[model samples]
Target: MPSDTEQRTRAAVPADAVTEPLTDIIDPDNFTPRLLALLSNALVWRESHELRRRFGLGTNDWRIISSLAIRPGASATEVSDFIGLNKAVISKGVVKLVDRGLVLLVDGPRGSRPMYLTPAGAEMHDAMLPISMRGQEIILADLSADDIDRLNALLRRMLEKTRELHVLENGSDVGADD
Candidate 1:
Protein backbone atom coordinates (compact mmCIF):
# COMPACT_ATOMS: atom_id res chain seq x y z
CA MET A 1 0.00 0.00 0.00
CA PRO A 2 3.10 2.33 -0.01
CA SER A 3 3.51 5.04 -2.61
CA ASP A 4 5.89 4.65 -5.56
CA THR A 5 8.56 6.86 -3.89
CA GLU A 6 8.44 4.81 -0.73
CA GLN A 7 8.76 1.61 -2.70
CA ARG A 8 11.73 3.00 -4.56
CA THR A 9 13.37 4.13 -1.32
CA ARG A 10 12.93 0.74 0.25
CA ALA A 11 14.28 -0.94 -2.84
CA ALA A 12 17.41 1.24 -2.65
CA VAL A 13 18.33 -0.25 0.69
CA PRO A 14 19.99 -3.65 0.68
CA ALA A 15 18.52 -6.30 2.97
CA ASP A 16 22.02 -7.56 3.87
CA ALA A 17 23.64 -4.13 3.84
CA VAL A 18 27.11 -4.04 5.34
CA THR A 19 28.83 -1.02 6.80
CA GLU A 20 32.12 0.13 5.39
CA PRO A 21 35.14 0.09 7.64
CA LEU A 22 36.27 3.57 6.68
CA THR A 23 32.84 5.19 6.89
CA ASP A 24 31.66 6.60 10.20
CA ILE A 25 28.49 5.15 11.63
CA ILE A 26 27.36 8.51 12.96
CA ASP A 27 28.30 10.30 9.75
CA PRO A 28 26.98 7.87 7.20
CA ASP A 29 25.90 10.76 5.02
CA ASN A 30 26.84 13.99 6.71
CA PHE A 31 28.15 15.48 9.97
CA THR A 32 27.05 13.72 13.13
CA PRO A 33 27.75 14.31 16.82
CA ARG A 34 30.59 11.78 16.91
CA LEU A 35 32.12 13.27 13.81
CA LEU A 36 31.81 16.72 15.28
CA ALA A 37 33.54 15.63 18.47
CA LEU A 38 36.44 14.10 16.54
CA LEU A 39 36.77 17.20 14.39
CA SER A 40 36.70 19.43 17.45
CA ASN A 41 39.40 17.44 19.17
CA ALA A 42 41.55 17.49 16.04
CA LEU A 43 41.16 21.25 15.64
CA VAL A 44 41.97 21.93 19.29
CA TRP A 45 44.99 19.68 19.14
CA ARG A 46 46.17 21.44 16.02
CA GLU A 47 45.81 24.85 17.59
CA SER A 48 47.61 23.77 20.75
CA HIS A 49 50.40 22.23 18.70
CA GLU A 50 50.78 25.45 16.74
CA LEU A 51 50.97 27.46 19.94
CA ARG A 52 53.57 25.12 21.39
CA ARG A 53 55.66 25.40 18.23
CA ARG A 54 55.56 29.19 18.49
CA PHE A 55 56.67 29.01 22.13
CA GLY A 56 59.55 26.64 21.33
CA LEU A 57 57.80 23.94 23.32
CA GLY A 58 56.45 20.50 22.48
CA THR A 59 52.84 19.51 22.97
CA ASN A 60 53.70 17.51 26.07
CA ASP A 61 55.68 20.41 27.52
CA TRP A 62 52.82 22.78 26.86
CA ARG A 63 50.40 20.36 28.48
CA ILE A 64 52.57 20.17 31.61
CA ILE A 65 53.02 23.91 31.63
CA SER A 66 49.30 24.48 31.34
CA SER A 67 48.60 21.90 34.02
CA LEU A 68 51.00 23.63 36.39
CA ALA A 69 49.42 26.94 35.51
CA ILE A 70 46.15 25.53 36.83
CA ARG A 71 47.82 24.40 40.08
CA PRO A 72 51.35 25.61 40.53
CA GLY A 73 53.91 23.60 42.50
CA ALA A 74 52.32 20.30 41.64
CA SER A 75 54.63 17.30 41.74
CA ALA A 76 55.94 15.66 38.57
CA THR A 77 53.80 12.64 39.36
CA GLU A 78 50.78 14.87 39.56
CA VAL A 79 51.68 16.53 36.30
CA SER A 80 52.15 13.17 34.61
CA ASP A 81 48.85 11.91 35.92
CA PHE A 82 47.00 15.06 34.95
CA ILE A 83 48.48 15.12 31.47
CA GLY A 84 47.86 11.40 30.98
CA LEU A 85 51.43 10.77 30.01
CA ASN A 86 53.81 8.21 31.47
CA LYS A 87 56.41 9.23 34.06
CA ALA A 88 59.32 8.93 31.66
CA VAL A 89 57.69 11.28 29.18
CA ILE A 90 56.76 13.77 31.91
CA SER A 91 60.30 13.63 33.32
CA LYS A 92 61.82 14.48 29.97
CA GLY A 93 59.31 17.26 29.41
CA VAL A 94 59.96 18.73 32.87
CA VAL A 95 63.72 18.58 32.27
CA LYS A 96 63.31 20.38 28.98
CA LEU A 97 61.06 23.03 30.48
CA VAL A 98 63.47 23.52 33.37
CA ASP A 99 66.39 23.83 30.96
CA ARG A 100 64.47 26.52 29.09
CA GLY A 101 63.96 28.45 32.37
CA LEU A 102 60.20 28.25 32.02
CA VAL A 103 59.55 26.16 35.12
CA LEU A 104 61.03 25.87 38.61
CA LEU A 105 61.56 22.73 40.63
CA VAL A 106 60.85 22.99 44.32
CA ASP A 107 62.03 20.52 46.91
CA GLY A 108 59.27 19.05 49.02
CA PRO A 109 59.30 17.00 52.22
CA ARG A 110 60.68 13.45 52.18
CA GLY A 111 62.63 14.11 48.99
CA SER A 112 59.49 14.97 47.08
CA ARG A 113 59.73 17.52 44.29
CA PRO A 114 57.22 19.81 42.65
CA MET A 115 57.22 22.18 39.74
CA TYR A 116 55.96 25.73 39.46
CA LEU A 117 55.86 28.11 36.58
CA THR A 118 58.47 30.82 36.72
CA PRO A 119 57.85 34.47 35.89
CA ALA A 120 58.77 33.78 32.28
CA GLY A 121 56.44 30.79 32.25
CA ALA A 122 53.66 32.89 33.74
CA GLU A 123 54.22 35.44 31.00
CA MET A 124 53.99 32.66 28.44
CA HIS A 125 50.76 31.48 29.99
CA ASP A 126 49.35 34.98 29.76
CA ALA A 127 50.41 35.21 26.15
CA MET A 128 48.82 31.86 25.34
CA LEU A 129 45.53 32.72 27.03
CA PRO A 130 44.19 34.94 24.26
CA ILE A 131 45.05 32.43 21.59
CA SER A 132 43.38 29.61 23.52
CA MET A 133 40.30 31.71 24.14
CA ARG A 134 40.04 32.68 20.51
CA GLY A 135 40.21 29.08 19.46
CA GLN A 136 37.52 28.15 21.96
CA GLU A 137 35.30 30.96 20.75
CA ILE A 138 35.61 29.98 17.13
CA ILE A 139 34.76 26.40 18.00
CA LEU A 140 31.73 27.23 20.09
CA ALA A 141 30.49 30.54 18.73
CA ASP A 142 27.43 29.15 16.99
CA LEU A 143 26.11 27.48 20.14
CA SER A 144 24.21 29.33 22.85
CA ALA A 145 25.59 29.44 26.38
CA ASP A 146 23.01 26.96 27.57
CA ASP A 147 23.74 24.69 24.64
CA ILE A 148 27.43 24.84 25.37
CA ASP A 149 26.89 24.08 29.04
CA ARG A 150 24.71 21.10 28.19
CA LEU A 151 27.20 19.86 25.62
CA ASN A 152 30.05 20.18 28.08
CA ALA A 153 28.10 18.28 30.72
CA LEU A 154 27.29 15.55 28.22
CA LEU A 155 30.89 15.29 27.13
CA ARG A 156 32.10 15.03 30.71
CA ARG A 157 29.54 12.33 31.44
CA MET A 158 30.52 10.46 28.32
CA LEU A 159 34.15 10.56 29.38
CA GLU A 160 33.33 9.19 32.81
CA LYS A 161 31.07 6.48 31.42
CA THR A 162 33.65 5.51 28.86
CA ARG A 163 36.24 5.17 31.60
CA GLU A 164 33.93 2.93 33.54
CA LEU A 165 33.23 0.82 30.47
CA HIS A 166 36.97 0.56 29.84
CA VAL A 167 37.56 -0.61 33.39
CA LEU A 168 34.85 -3.23 33.05
CA GLU A 169 36.13 -4.40 29.69
CA ASN A 170 39.76 -4.73 30.75
CA GLY A 171 39.45 -5.21 34.48
CA SER A 172 42.05 -2.45 34.96
CA ASP A 173 41.88 1.15 35.94
CA VAL A 174 42.00 3.68 33.13
CA GLY A 175 43.34 6.28 35.53
CA ALA A 176 41.91 8.89 33.24
CA ASP A 177 41.37 11.48 35.93
CA ASP A 178 44.63 12.52 37.46
Candidate 2:
Protein backbone atom coordinates (compact mmCIF):
# COMPACT_ATOMS: atom_id res chain seq x y z
CA MET A 1 0.00 0.00 0.00
CA PRO A 2 1.31 3.41 -0.94
CA SER A 3 1.14 6.41 1.37
CA ASP A 4 -0.88 9.42 0.24
CA THR A 5 2.28 11.37 -0.52
CA GLU A 6 3.74 8.51 -2.51
CA GLN A 7 0.56 8.11 -4.45
CA ARG A 8 0.44 11.79 -5.18
CA THR A 9 4.05 11.81 -6.20
CA ARG A 10 3.50 8.93 -8.58
CA ALA A 11 0.46 10.59 -10.05
CA ALA A 12 2.36 13.83 -10.52
CA VAL A 13 5.14 12.30 -12.57
CA PRO A 14 4.98 13.48 -16.20
CA ALA A 15 3.92 11.02 -18.83
CA ASP A 16 7.30 11.51 -20.51
CA ALA A 17 9.10 10.30 -17.41
CA VAL A 18 9.64 7.03 -19.22
CA THR A 19 12.40 7.72 -21.66
CA GLU A 20 12.58 6.30 -25.18
CA PRO A 21 13.42 2.65 -25.55
CA LEU A 22 17.12 1.86 -25.53
CA THR A 23 18.13 0.67 -28.99
CA ASP A 24 21.33 -1.13 -28.02
CA ILE A 25 22.94 -2.51 -24.88
CA ILE A 26 26.32 -1.04 -25.77
CA ASP A 27 24.99 2.46 -26.17
CA PRO A 28 26.17 4.61 -23.25
CA ASP A 29 22.81 6.38 -23.11
CA ASN A 30 21.08 3.05 -22.74
CA PHE A 31 23.10 1.94 -19.71
CA THR A 32 22.29 3.41 -16.35
CA PRO A 33 25.64 2.44 -14.81
CA ARG A 34 27.51 4.06 -17.67
CA LEU A 35 25.49 7.20 -17.26
CA LEU A 36 26.20 7.19 -13.54
CA ALA A 37 29.90 6.69 -14.15
CA LEU A 38 29.92 9.50 -16.65
CA LEU A 39 28.25 11.81 -14.20
CA SER A 40 30.67 10.86 -11.42
CA ASN A 41 33.68 11.32 -13.65
CA ALA A 42 32.48 14.67 -14.90
CA LEU A 43 31.73 15.97 -11.42
CA VAL A 44 35.08 14.80 -10.05
CA TRP A 45 37.02 16.24 -12.99
CA ARG A 46 35.40 19.63 -12.65
CA GLU A 47 35.64 19.77 -8.89
CA SER A 48 39.25 18.58 -8.86
CA HIS A 49 40.29 21.40 -11.14
CA GLU A 50 38.52 24.01 -9.05
CA LEU A 51 39.83 22.59 -5.78
CA ARG A 52 43.39 22.50 -7.07
CA ARG A 53 43.20 26.04 -8.33
CA ARG A 54 41.68 27.49 -5.18
CA PHE A 55 42.94 25.29 -2.36
CA GLY A 56 45.96 23.51 -3.76
CA LEU A 57 44.21 20.26 -3.03
CA GLY A 58 42.70 17.48 -5.10
CA THR A 59 39.28 15.94 -4.81
CA ASN A 60 40.65 13.08 -2.70
CA ASP A 61 42.22 15.55 -0.30
CA TRP A 62 38.98 17.42 0.04
CA ARG A 63 37.16 14.16 0.56
CA ILE A 64 39.50 13.21 3.37
CA ILE A 65 39.09 16.62 4.94
CA SER A 66 35.35 16.42 4.66
CA SER A 67 35.32 12.95 6.12
CA LEU A 68 37.46 14.07 9.04
CA ALA A 69 35.26 17.09 9.54
CA ILE A 70 32.32 14.77 10.02
CA ARG A 71 34.10 11.88 11.74
CA PRO A 72 37.03 13.26 13.60
CA GLY A 73 39.57 10.70 14.84
CA ALA A 74 38.63 8.24 12.12
CA SER A 75 41.34 5.93 10.88
CA ALA A 76 42.45 5.95 7.28
CA THR A 77 40.84 2.55 6.83
CA GLU A 78 37.62 3.77 8.36
CA VAL A 79 37.51 6.85 6.18
CA SER A 80 38.33 4.74 3.14
CA ASP A 81 35.49 2.37 3.94
CA PHE A 82 33.03 5.15 4.66
CA ILE A 83 33.93 7.11 1.56
CA GLY A 84 34.00 4.03 -0.73
CA LEU A 85 37.51 4.87 -1.79
CA ASN A 86 40.63 2.69 -1.80
CA LYS A 87 42.63 2.62 1.42
CA ALA A 88 45.79 3.58 -0.42
CA VAL A 89 44.09 6.58 -1.90
CA ILE A 90 42.84 7.60 1.53
CA SER A 91 46.31 7.12 2.99
CA LYS A 92 47.87 9.27 0.27
CA GLY A 93 45.29 11.95 0.82
CA VAL A 94 45.88 11.81 4.54
CA VAL A 95 49.57 12.22 4.01
CA LYS A 96 48.97 15.27 1.88
CA LEU A 97 46.58 16.75 4.41
CA VAL A 98 49.03 16.13 7.26
CA ASP A 99 51.93 17.65 5.36
CA ARG A 100 49.84 20.70 4.58
CA GLY A 101 49.11 21.18 8.31
CA LEU A 102 45.43 20.52 7.74
CA VAL A 103 45.18 17.17 9.47
CA LEU A 104 46.79 15.64 12.54
CA LEU A 105 47.43 11.93 12.89
CA VAL A 106 47.57 10.65 16.41
CA ASP A 107 48.43 7.26 17.82
CA GLY A 108 45.43 5.10 18.45
CA PRO A 109 44.76 1.72 20.02
CA ARG A 110 46.66 -1.22 18.50
CA GLY A 111 48.94 0.99 16.40
CA SER A 112 46.08 2.45 14.38
CA ARG A 113 46.47 6.09 13.53
CA PRO A 114 43.42 8.24 14.14
CA MET A 115 43.04 11.33 12.00
CA TYR A 116 41.54 14.70 12.92
CA LEU A 117 41.35 18.04 11.19
CA THR A 118 43.55 20.83 12.48
CA PRO A 119 42.10 24.26 13.09
CA ALA A 120 43.34 25.26 9.65
CA GLY A 121 41.73 22.18 8.16
CA ALA A 122 38.41 23.03 9.80
CA GLU A 123 38.66 26.52 8.37
CA MET A 124 39.43 25.11 4.94
CA HIS A 125 36.49 22.75 5.15
CA ASP A 126 34.21 25.63 6.15
CA ALA A 127 35.45 27.73 3.27
CA MET A 128 34.93 24.93 0.77
CA LEU A 129 31.52 23.91 2.07
CA PRO A 130 29.63 26.75 0.42
CA ILE A 131 31.18 25.96 -2.94
CA SER A 132 30.24 22.33 -2.61
CA MET A 133 26.73 23.21 -1.50
CA ARG A 134 26.31 25.69 -4.34
CA GLY A 135 27.41 23.10 -6.84
CA GLN A 136 24.88 20.66 -5.43
CA GLU A 137 22.18 23.32 -5.60
CA ILE A 138 23.00 24.15 -9.18
CA ILE A 139 22.94 20.52 -10.26
CA LEU A 140 19.73 19.85 -8.37
CA ALA A 141 17.94 23.05 -9.30
CA ASP A 142 15.51 21.19 -11.50
CA LEU A 143 14.53 18.73 -8.77
CA SER A 144 11.91 19.23 -6.12
CA ALA A 145 12.89 18.60 -2.51
CA ASP A 146 10.86 15.41 -2.50
CA ASP A 147 12.48 14.31 -5.72
CA ILE A 148 15.96 15.00 -4.37
CA ASP A 149 15.25 13.02 -1.21
CA ARG A 150 13.91 10.13 -3.24
CA LEU A 151 16.89 10.19 -5.55
CA ASN A 152 19.29 10.16 -2.63
CA ALA A 153 17.45 7.26 -1.04
CA LEU A 154 17.60 5.32 -4.29
CA LEU A 155 21.30 6.02 -4.69
CA ARG A 156 22.02 4.87 -1.13
CA ARG A 157 20.15 1.65 -1.77
CA MET A 158 22.15 1.09 -4.93
CA LEU A 159 25.36 1.70 -3.00
CA GLU A 160 24.33 -0.89 -0.45
CA LYS A 161 23.67 -3.35 -3.23
CA THR A 162 27.16 -2.74 -4.59
CA ARG A 163 28.63 -3.34 -1.17
CA GLU A 164 26.73 -6.61 -0.91
CA LEU A 165 28.01 -7.68 -4.28
CA HIS A 166 31.55 -6.71 -3.38
CA VAL A 167 31.45 -8.73 -0.16
CA LEU A 168 30.09 -11.72 -1.99
CA GLU A 169 32.85 -11.56 -4.57
CA ASN A 170 35.68 -10.72 -2.15
CA GLY A 171 34.76 -13.04 0.70
CA SER A 172 34.70 -10.22 3.30
CA ASP A 173 38.37 -9.35 2.93
CA VAL A 174 37.56 -6.24 0.98
CA GLY A 175 40.59 -4.13 0.01
CA ALA A 176 42.98 -6.35 1.91
CA ASP A 177 45.94 -5.18 -0.11
CA ASP A 178 44.70 -1.61 -0.20
Q: Write the per-residue lDDT of candidate 1 for residues 24-83, one digit (tens) a residue.
A: 345444656668778768867876687867876756777788899998989988877676
lDDT of each: 0.80, 0.86
User: Per-prediction count of colliding residue pairs?
Assistant: 0, 0
Return the TM-score for each candidate structure.
Answer: 0.71, 0.81
All models, RMSD in angstroms: 8.6, 14.2
**TM-score of predicted model 1?**
0.71
TM-score of 2: 0.81
User: Tens-digit lDDT track for model 2 on 1-105?
Assistant: 999998998899898796467775486677898888887788788888888889999889988999999999999998987777899899888888899999999
Q: In candidate 2, what residue range of length 10 has the lowest lDDT sum?
A: 169-178
Clashing pairs in 1: none
Off by over 4 Å in 2: 1-25, 173-178
Which residue pairs collide in model 2, if any?
none
